[model samples]
Target: MKTYLPSTSYEYATVQKVAGTTITEASDVLAAEEPLEIRLGYGPAGQRQHRTLSITMRTPGHDFELTAGFLLTEGIIRSRADLTGILYCPDVAKDEERENVVRAELVPGLSLDLPRLERHFYTSSSCGVCGKTSIDAVHATSCPVLPTDGPYLDVAVVHELPARQRAAQALFEQTGGLHAAALFSPAGELLLLREDVGRHNALDKVIGAALLAEWLPLHQHVLLVSGRASFELVQKAAVAGIPIMAAVGAPSSLAVQAATNFGMTLLGFVRQQRYNVYCHGWRLVNQQPAGGPDKVA
Candidate 1:
């Protein structure tokens, strides 16, 4: 396993706490949000070139993994072999811009399709989920069909994941302002937890971390999101080949469709003793459909 480098998650802010009748001033911690610029560097030896890929509003750290995972999910690059090196640019022309930019050097001969990439942003913080509208849906290209023969999970184990994910949410506990995504083993062990201001970004962080650890094609594992499962989250999981995805909140309409079409087992409203499996029910051992004869919408 790769040892993840620790990153700071919060900054101090002054606030007023209200009681039954009195108000007390207090200092509180808040999740930090910042813009990160992603640049892709490619071509051969002396003629290497760099292009601004994207800039996103994100929490300040785990940046390299975020960019890597974003590129992969966007179909820009595949495996770790596609990268020669990744580092935060230390020499921006402006002093304040230095640490906010990361340059990913791609291996020789590979090229980026700019027109296709333009469909994503031309690269900006306002870049939508797939660069169309707000981060509302997954790009069709990002989510291909997933494997049907991935893994089986019991309903009992599915219910256990949200609590496990919640236990590792240190930043959320402190600030309550960030969304989280966690990767877990089929046995319900937490593998990785990534927190972010946006739900999509959090999933990207987790997938990116898995990629760096050479743990891609998560066929036998589960992904538990602290928030609702959106199409973007399901797409990220499908791209990473995770067989199951559970959400503490709920699944969006597009998310349910995507999960059903992609052969992924998606569940929502995971709580103490029950959870609703949205689709691909065959993968849940000893589980049955809830509604007796509800018509398929």
Candidate 2:
């Protein structure tokens, strides 16, 4: 594995600030958005095959973790043992190009279902996969149904997560443009956090870090996102075996359905002193009944 260096997460830009009638030019911090190409190296040892797996626009940091997480969540690779090494593409001529491209080497002769991978990429790129098909695809993967036995979280703890996540968002404080994903214990202690311009990428980085550290199947932890919960985010969390997920913003209808199907607790609008429990509310303690109408069939 090549030495991994941190990439610049923010950039400096000159902006015109308008306050009342006065206008002044000042330096502003902007979150960096760059394209990262993920490559896969597989096949036999002496004769290896390389392919560009994906290219994504993300904040230029935690590229390796992002790559790893993408693979796992996409159902390309199951665990860290499948990856032989991850490194920046050293074959590139320019240093800048090299950093933007990452190569994940798979263990020699590891079986890969190429057609499924291609179909997945094609569906995602073309936006042709319907909601049902997408959900069905997730079920087709090795993602397991979340357990309901334990790791119950307190309502107070859930309420404090947004503030805690906000306070620890160093990059977001600088640019105010980055999204963040954080993992916390049931007692509300922050464990791992990752930030990026894209919400999915941020979650991918967090999952990737945990995957590399052999801390996967995060069934005992709660996941928090700085933005609205999407189906993709819920899918990734479910694949990682996260039992509970909270978002600062509202969740889409599909997100709720997917979470419901997976037996994962989904919380939305987790701010101020309260939040909405979309499904599987049994895992939350100190919670009163919503007393709303019957569930829509």
Candidate 3:
């Protein structure tokens, strides 16, 4: 068993706070960010087609989920059953290095496309692997264009999602420097929540877990992101089969465009019982007729 260690998600650091005429020095716990190398394994049972997928900076914990989730959205692994096993690489030279690298083993007779692995484009914590080749690149092979009849999202439920998502963010409550991705049912029931210093990493963890729990193409679910909705984040959600995505911040221009292209409902500034629907407002249960909304959702 890997022995228990103190929290590595946050570390204490001393900083000076400058006032009008005084300088106060105190310790603060900042969210931890470290490099996590995600590797993939395939080929015959005895043969290891090991290859490095991508190395991203993420908060500690949920390393395997992050790896699986990344592969799922990348159009590599389609479903949870495609995953054979995921663990920290046994080749770590030191104990502390164990958490720095993760390897995912594919199921028997299954293998990854070597050329597709080249598409592993994430190189940092801020940006995900959106190479901007084309709008169609964001669409995964496993994800057909979302139909118009997936799930219904009420404006009231959308407004409540941010508060509920905030309540479930334990790490964020402590560090205030982490991003969160939460999954909710069509009825607004919070299902799963994951947090990380990287926005992309947070979505990866949740989608990875859902994939394991056999919950792909979460057609009847709503995804709530704690930060701004980016094209990459929306792309990840769409890959996971999520129909509606609500964000507490603004949606980027590309993000709005992609959501519109995918026929997914996208909501922004989802707080205080108000939100803006950038695209696919048809899915909002509070939307009005050809006229205006009765009360303006």
Q: Each candidate's lDDT (Cα)?
A: 0.78, 0.89, 0.82
Report the candidate with higher lDDT, 2 versus 3. Answer: 2
Q: Rank the candidates by lDDT, best first.
A: 2, 3, 1
How much is the lDDT of residue 274 in candidate 3? 68
At residue 164, give the lDDT of candidate 2: 95
Candidate 1 per-residue lDDT over residues 240-289, each given as its tens digit:
88888988888888788877777888888887666777888777775555
Instruction: Itemize residue pairs with steric clashes in candidate 1.
Output: none
Query: Which wins on TM-score, candidate 2 or candidate 3?
Result: 2
Per-residue alpha-carbon lDDT of candidate 2 for residues 153-189, written as tens digits (9 for 90 to 100): 9887887999999988888887799899999999999
Local lDDT at 181 for model 2: 99
C-alpha-based local distance difference test score of model 1: 0.78
> For model 3, how does the per-residue alpha-carbon lDDT over 170-270 read when each residue is reduced to its tens digit?
77777789999999998889999999999989999999999888876788888999889998888888888787998989999988988888888999888
Choose the strongest candidate by lDDT.
2
RMSD of each: 4.4, 4.2, 3.8
